[model samples]
Target: MRIKNSTVVITGADSGIGRATALRFAKKGARVVLASRDAAALETLAADCRRRGAKALAVQTDVADPEAVEELCESAVGNFGRIDIWVNNAGTGVFGPFLDTPLEDIQRVVDVDLMGVVHGAREALEQMRAQGEGVLINVASMAGIIPQPYTSAYSMSKAAVRALGVSLRSELRLARVKDIHVVTVSPGAVDTPFFDHVANYTGQDTRPIPPTYSPDKIAAAIVNVARSPQRELTVGLIPKAMVAKHKLFPQAVERRMATLTHRKHLKATQPAPPTKGNLDRAAGDDATGRRGRKTGGHGGRTKTMARRLLVIGGAAGVTAFAAFRWRQ
Candidate 1:
């Protein structure tokens, strides 16, 4: 679908990838509908979108609430007539050992990250049915495809998000809704306030793992996907490599992730008390920023650690043996 004159609804438009995507679509001449729990932030983004030469609406919403998502769709169609594209970018995270993390926090993660996507997809599909066509872009994570060592709740939620999109697409295909597209975007650690907002229980200041990309990278993918929908879109070279590595050398990649998530994520920052973040309610002013603080200047050390982990974890030999067998 052409971005110009298309109506696009983006959840979590207050910050991070959602914010970037909202601006991107707006600049492309699409009418933008912004949804998030932060009313003030959404309003600000709405103003920005208007400045970008697109009609904009800011709908304060918690995507975890099916009612709120329903209202969002109603508002969009009520205002714009129909939604041409819906980007399910609303997400939250809880970063800690699965066993140590509170059940509530885990539930919150699922509510926002996985079920949030489900709610948006369902609502979008309903609206698309009315129009007979639409696009659903879900922002998943590379961690969804591979295990992150410490953030089990977040990792699991993302994995479920991917599954949700894939399953929905298959159902849509069977139903012959060929023009209604469901697209999943998987990006590695991105330089966005997403890290600053996750519920933290590791007793340390959170840091995004290495090989981070800017939010614009993911936003561009979203816009591009809207132009021509694909089943799965992975952003960043490292993210693509990580997914491939996980597919062909799961043990090796798991070991590497374990080692780095310890040194690079958990132990790299100062200690802090556990918090539920924005999962339970609206995020604080601290979550207002769009970009992450970490520049991740330690790529060399991470690469070295990855090599050492592969050798020590015995996966290097496994890869070589598999290659040899394939050649034979």
Candidate 2:
């Protein structure tokens, strides 16, 4: 599908990957709608898009609310006359031991990550079915393929998203809607506000991983996926290797994760005052027009350590596997 003049609606477009993607598409001459709870941020993004000479609209939306999602789609269609692409990018994460994590926090993560995607797909499919063409892009994470120790809720939500994307792709095909495409974009540790906004059980500020890609890299990949829909695309070489290793040696992968978790250093630190302006907040909350500062907490530290171990183990596993294959 040609990007120029296409109507695309992006949820969570106030900042981060969604914001980057919105700008990318708008620059390509696509009619773009920026949707999020932050009306002010959405307006800012829309203005920027307009300045770039692309038609744009800002729709204040809470994807967890089915009614809000419905209105979002309606507003997009009302403004653009049709929906060509729907990118379900709005999401939130909570990090803590599954047993210790608040049920409310878990439910909130599930609501935004999993159910939100469901709502976006439902609305986009209905409208696309009518037009006989469209695209749906679900932003999943590397955690979708590999379960993380301290971030069980987040892992579960992403895993569900992966399943949802696969199931929806098949269902759309069965319905004979060949023109409509469903693609999942799995990104590794990207430099986004996701970490800063993640709910942390242990009180600490968010920190960055040693190596992280900018949102622009992810936006570029999403644009490519929209142009040529693939069932799933994994970004980053390390993440791709981890996914492959898990598939070939599930037991070994599980054992590696267990070992890393057991060795993680966790201190009983005072929880930081719960911060406002998470992804769940309205767009105006992110008025800085920048990715939120990442927080480093007990949960975040454990997960970070685990990821480092996984990289080392995954690399070793790959090397061994390659040698074995060569010998064979």
Candidate 1 clash pair list = none
Regions of model 2 farther than 4 Å from truth:
254-280, 283-288, 295-328
Assess candidate 2 and give its lDDT.
Answer: 0.79
lDDT accuracy of residue 209 in candidate 1: 77
Error of 1 at 125 (Å): 0.5
All models: lDDT? 0.83, 0.79
lDDT of 2 at 302: 32
Candidate 1 per-residue lDDT, tens place, 55-145, comes to 9999999999999999999999999999999999988888888788999888888888888888999889988988899899988888888
Backbone clashes in each candidate structure, one number apiece? 0, 10
